[model samples]
Target: MPLFIRSVRLYPVNDNETFHRRFSVNVAVLGSLNLDVVFHCEALPIPGQTLLCDDFATGPGGKGLNQAVAARRAGAETSLLGAVGADASGDALLSFLKREDILTHGVVTLADAPTGVAHIVVDRDGENSIIVASGANRAVPADRLATAGLQALVWLAQLEMDIEVVGGFLREGRQAGARTILNAAPAIEAARSLFGDADLIIVNEHELAQFSGVPCPAGNDAAIEQAARKLMVRDDQILIVTLGAKGTQLVDSRSSFHVAAAPVVAVDTTGAGDCFCGVLAASLAQGASVPDAVRRANIAAGIAVGRTGAAPAMPLKDEIEAVSNG
Candidate 1:
């Protein structure tokens, strides 16, 4: 099956408004919300060794929150469905989402659990090591979508939450005639059950190897394609393998293609994948073809890596357009 771009109408408004409406897509994100505690270090510590960091900071983060921000910044009507602890961290996270104009009615506050937290250490090369505490993120129920009242053309989810909960969300989205996407990050054995339910599946090289049981090295295009094809559940189902600096590879039953990443000096790689996933979902919701969506996402992610933080590093719609046109 071939994918084609949909026709877009330019509205009579300000330049920014017009551009926004041109790609105004409705997207729902169901995943986790966490407060990130970051340590800037020269190098990560080994076991039983103590390491000192140059600086430290804390901010709102989580795959769900980051992706929601990315989609909204990319000009999508985005809604987030997840859980947070009934703490100040949760309140601040909620406030941050509101400031980003993301719908938060689906995000529940739980009393018994603490807000999820991620301890991240970034080195000079922009690579990071992270350890996450599931906390309230694991408390999100499977029925959140029913009460969320979110009407979307694209439903996006990640594995930061329970597998059953994410699976339920994807199944319900499919039943509601929405295109479901699963970003199989932090790859788990149970996530394999979702490959058939999602219309689009996004993963990195390591995740591709985990899911497909194939060795997907960074530069091996043939091995990557072979692994990607094994994850296809339907003729039209598309699987995207993010190759970091090498760009991304797209595979479906009918064909496969590769898109190169935009050249940029990265200061922090955090949230680059989330930006890609969110922008990709937004583009698809707005009826962009698969190839165009991947290209736009690649450009947006390039911009994100040049900055710091996760959600805050996401590029605006016009920024991505400018880079694309340049």
Candidate 2:
């Protein structure tokens, strides 16, 4: 059966602000935190072989953490709800978030559960393979997250937790009258439950298939759009299929619109999708309809892909706006 969903407006996202309280957008992220250990290889070494890294760094990451920081940098007052180990990696992660200004009040610190860490290998061209040791993150016990008064609730989840936790959060957001957006990354079998509750399902070309079970475009945007239209409320709920340089195709309750990608020589595509979704959520909280928000997000993503590293690559609001206005 088709996922049960509600209708969403189709107009292009507008760049404006409408808040229940303040000027900035407010967003809550229900997800994980991780310390990213990167291996900068010219090319991935063969299995059972060793490849040396030319450069490396450790930083705060994981879809939830990346998206939260990106949203905050993009001008959203964001909060993160998840667990982290009390290790040195956890300390640095918290410190970095403090610098970025995301609400860390809700982070659960576990002494024994060592903070989650993702071992990543990225080739010179930015293609990557990652394995996550979801230490503290796996503590996703099934419970409804307390939803106070946030403009939106987002889930950048990995299926490291029970599906009940995901379901509980969605229900909590609905109860609190917040826009519920899910950035279902590393799409897993249980992640399927997200569609029914999401106001917007942000997907890359590969992830779109993982969710909709529909094959991504065999060739072009038209094929992809057709596939996306099959999932969720194609004409109602927001279905954004990001096409890298090809830009994005947004389908809503009425008609679909295509936003052209801004040109940039990509140094690292890591976290670009998270940047886009983060901006999209922030822009939506700022009262931007999908088109305007997504247009601006496309520009923001361009800025992120132009640099290296995950969190370090996200551009600030002014920088993103400058590129968007250009």
**TM-score leader:** 1
lDDT of 2 by residue, 244-272 (tens): 88899886666677889987887778788
- How far out, in Å, is residue 256 in model 1? 1.3
lDDT of each: 0.87, 0.74
Instruction: In angstroms, give how far residue 181 of model 1 lies from its true place.
Output: 0.4
Top candidate on lDDT is 1
In candidate 2, position 292 carries an lDDT of 93
lDDT for position 28 in model 1: 88
Q: Over the stretch 147-187, how does candidate 1's per-residue lDDT look in tens digits?
A: 23345789999999998899889988898789999999989
Clashing pairs counted in every model: 0, 8
lDDT of 2 at 188: 74
lDDT of 2 at 165: 77
